[model samples]
Target: MSAIFNFQSLLTVILLLICTCAYIRSLAPSILDRNKTGLLGIFWKCARIESRLELQ
Candidate 1:
């Protein structure tokens, strides 16, 4: 019973992380499309990481 409870908690955390990454990916294109500054470099790094991950 304890094992089952722990597994459920772990699964919940994994799902939450997946959702958060998907949300960030959805926002990635907008940053690249516009000529916005400040956060631009951060977004570019994320986009590069995302492309590398896709290639892998």
Candidate 2:
């Protein structure tokens, strides 16, 4: 139905945005590193913790 088509379109757009953000973050990680209080900062902290755990 039309509703299902609209939902799929919205989901695709959301996925694309997430992918673009991840790509940008990979290209310039320092940008996230400098903002230690934002959402990305939380993710960065978790990633650092995970890496540290893997090292042990």
Candidate 3:
């Protein structure tokens, strides 16, 4: 029972750290540059193609 509690606490701390890192990265300028040229870039390209297909 005590072990389970300890494990849960450790997991919660790790999750908090990951969330904090993600939030910080989201606010950073480097993330914005990736958004313009990363997987999101490919996603947007596909979305445009789909829209054109629907219009035609």
What lDDT would candidate 2 get against the real structure?
0.61
lDDT of 1: 0.57
Relative to the true structure, how large is the alpha-carbon lDDT of every model? 0.57, 0.61, 0.52
Position 12, candidate 1: lDDT: 75
Question: How well does candidate 1 score on lDDT at residue 50?
Answer: 54
Per-candidate TM equals: 0.41, 0.47, 0.42
The best candidate in terms of lDDT: 2
Worst 10 residues of 3 by lDDT: 42-51
Q: Per-residue lDDT tens digits of candidate 1, residues 1-56?
A: 45346988777765555555545657776645463356655554545555666678
Instruction: Give the backbone clash total of model 3.
Output: 0
Superposition error at 46 for model 3 (Å): 28
Clashes (candidate 1): 0
The list of candidate 2 runs beyond 4 A from truth reads 1-5, 33-56
Alpha-carbon deviation at 48 in model 2, angstroms:
12
For 1-56, candidate 2 gives per-residue lDDT tens digits of 45346988777765555555555556887875676776767655654554455579
